[model samples]
Target: MSAYTIRDATEADVPAIARVYEHAVLHGTATYELVPPPEAEMLTRFRAISGDGYPYIVAEDADGTLLGYAYGSAFRTRPAYRWSVEDSVYLEPSAQGRGIGLALLLRLVELCGELGFRQMIAVIGGGEHRPSIRIHEKAGFRHLGVMEASGFKFGRWIDTVLMQLPLGEGRDTLPDEATYPGTLFRG
Candidate 1:
């Protein structure tokens, strides 16, 4: 068996999730936020995602230390966008280069597909952030395009890269609208 485990994140994991994201916000261009959000804020965001019936999961080692997290959020708030989702993944240093990130992402893809989502997009921050891009690529995502100089952080302009993957049928076949989930989406 692998040294790490991947599972759905719970409320109790918020602190560790915050810590992982804080590392990225402070030291890496993987995220553009210059300041780390507080733990409480992280909890609120986590609750929102879970409440929306989206998948929020984490990776942990044998000792149960959180290594990273990955989730699928609404790609857009519009009703038409309900079938699409955008992926967000964050990996703590301990989990980097070990394929744990890929495992987490692929799992999110699987869960989202089961939830009736048709498309998954990865909006990676920092155009140069290849490891994140590679993880998405490894999950079968394809390059869409890049938005140059869209964000200014740390005294430099950062680009956003876009990649997309088709979940079940992609666009080859029309969805059976009657069987869709979240039909009552109050969002």
Candidate 2:
């Protein structure tokens, strides 16, 4: 097993997180974004998700070097979609093929469940991206479907694969007002 620790992310971690994401955006198809967002933009995004009570976490090795980061965000801006969250995970090149991605994803699922999220979605960028698909599958996510040619990155068309995992109670029960995800949207 890898000797890595996973913990809640802080403002101090944004720079490393941004670096990891920038690498993905530039060299990998995991994200469709062509231009890497600056650290300041990443910090704003982190604050938004953290402010909404969503979980954002980072993983580090025994030496305390950041290996990767993951987080859950509202699937959509609409209130009806509040109970569903979309997850994103990015890792450093040196950290790939280790168990860090799975560790981070499982923790994200656990935290989202505790926050009363009904569903967790993984929007895998390319249909050919098996590593991401495998990680989500190992984390209890099911293959939802795929949108072919949904994105054009790296001068080629890419397919987007959607996977989903049901969180606490999922949609089997209606959420009480206190547990409703829309509560975050309320003024």
Candidate 3:
């Protein structure tokens, strides 16, 4: 087992997080965005994710270097979708294939279950991303389906696969207020 620690991300982690995300956007297909999000925007999104009780986690070494991060966010804005959430996980290139992704994902699931979410979804970039698929499958996520050619990136159409894991059981209706939570969602 690698010696790494997982914890809630702090404002101090934004730069490292942004660097990780920028690396993905510029060099990998993990995210479909063609341009790196501005630091302010990233900070706003990070703040929103943490402020509303949505988990934003980071994995770090004993010396405090970031290795990976994962988080659970609202899947959609409709009140009916309140119990469903979308999860994202990213690791530093140097940390890939070292079990860091699995650890972060497992912890995200545990935290989401504790926060009362009933379903978790991962919108994977492609069906052949075996590492990502394996992590979700090993964590009990089922293959929901794939949206073929749903995204255009890098001058080509990219397929997106959806994986799901039910986190909790109970509750058939929303509360009287029924207002959707601002949990990593912009609406």
Candidate 4:
């Protein structure tokens, strides 16, 4: 087990987060983006997601080194999907397999559920990405399905794996409009 602390992300964390994501985009199949977005673009995205009242967090060591980050964002732009969120987690290469990713994910799920989200989805980029799939599974996500040959990256086609976890009351009960995360969607 690694020693780290998880906390809400601030603008100061964007640069480190961008570096982590850039490595993934450039060398891993976890994301389909062909080109890594620069820090400014990543900052823009961070503000958009956090501004929507979603949870974006970072994990850091006692020495303040960022190990990884995770966040929840609207699953889709449609109003009907307001209660569902898609989660993204990324870790520094050195931090992989150190239990940091799972920690970030569990925390993201807790924060999203607290904010009234009822469903969390993990869109694993490569069907063969066992570590991601295992992390999701460990955090209670169930295999939803897979999209075959849905992405072309690194000179080859890759399949995407879908996993889902129900949060809060899930679909067992109706959401209170006063506290629903959808309230953030309303202008």
Candidate 5:
């Protein structure tokens, strides 16, 4: 097993998180973003996600170096979407293929379930991006479909792959409004 620990992310992890995401924005199809957001922008995003009671987590090795991070966010802004969350996971280049991303994703799923979310959605950026698709599959996400040529990046069209996983009891039971995630209004 890898000697790494997964834990909730903190504001202090923003800089490292930004760096990891910057690399992806520049070189990878995992995200359709063309320009890397500044560190301040990253910090603002972190505040929005974590402050909203969503799950944001990081993985660190024994020496305490951050290898990757993952988080869940509201699938959409509407009240009806409150029970679903969109999952995001990113790894520092060196951390690829080390089981860290899957670990972070599984932890994100677990945390989202704890937060009363019923569905976890992964909109992977590229249809050809098998690594990400495989990771989500390994995390038990079911393939929904691919949105062909939904994104233009690197001067070419990229397809988005959609996958989903049920969280907790899913739709087997209804959520009590008072205990639903903060994205929804309490009863």
Candidate 6:
């Protein structure tokens, strides 16, 4: 809604993404990890997402200041779980309250649904992260309850809230890159 552009991420956006993620790790309970990964390691993780034909996108201004990013990746390694994906989204500390996270997440759902995903999952911190929960619910994800005390971080136990959105009914087949190469998203 603010005219930011969404595009598939390449290796070059790694540093911007890492910086945004680092802010969350340091200040917010959104991510359970204690220490932020180095830029190099972060790039490695994103590269794995790209290599798997998943969606990794960046929201940016015309001059390329990153506002936020969202992406979808395999929920589990097993082939049986290929049609379901776990989604991750993060906004720059300076970008919150401006709808960047919602915009990024909406685009993620667009891409995931087009790429043949049947179900999308979001894992959020319980109670303390209401903004994120509201964003996902606004975008149509259903609350699937919490995993109590599932993670230990910042010297205390944390709860994980799982939410999911089904892309659509049927369409259970796997993604066909051969038939749909270079198209960003299609219904």
- Could you give the C-alpha RMSD of every candidate to the true structure, in order shown? 1.7, 1.2, 2.8, 1.1, 1.4, 4.3
Q: What is the C-alpha lDDT of each candidate?
A: 0.89, 0.92, 0.85, 0.93, 0.91, 0.82
TM-score of 3: 0.90
Give each model's clash number. Answer: 0, 0, 0, 0, 0, 0
lDDT of 6 by residue, 63-95 (tens): 789888888887777665667788999998778
lDDT tens readout by residue for model 4, 73-137 = 98988888889999999999999999999999999999999889999999999998999999999
Residue range 108-144, candidate 3, lDDT tens digits: 9998877778789899986667899999999999998
Give the number of the best model, judged by lDDT.
Answer: 4
Write the candidate numbers in order of decreasing lDDT: 4, 2, 5, 1, 3, 6
Where is model 3 more than 4 Å wrong at Cα? 170-187
Per-residue lDDT of 1-187 in model 5, one digit per residue for the tens?
Answer: 4599999899999999999999999999998889999999999999988878888999998988889999998889888888899999999999999888898998889889888899999999989888899999999999999899999999999999999999999989998877887643444
User: What is the lDDT for 50 in model 2?
Assistant: 88
Candidate 5 vs candidate 6: which has greater lDDT? 5
lDDT string for model 2 (1-187, tens) is: 5699999999999999999999999999999999999999999999988888788999999988899999988888888788899999999999999989999999999988988899999999999999999999999999999999999999999999999999999989998766665346766
**Cα distance off (Å), candidate 3, residue 43:** 0.7
3 or 4, greater by TM-score: 4
TM-score on alpha carbons, each prediction: 0.94, 0.96, 0.90, 0.97, 0.96, 0.87
Off by over 4 Å in 4: 182-184
lDDT of 2: 0.92
Q: List the residue pairs that clash in candidate 2.
A: none
Runs of candidate 6 exceeding 4 Å displacement: 170-187
lDDT per residue as tens, model 1, 22-130? 9999888887888999999999999988888899999998899999999989888878888898999999896789898899999999999998889998889998898
> Which wins on TM-score, candidate 2 or candidate 6?
2
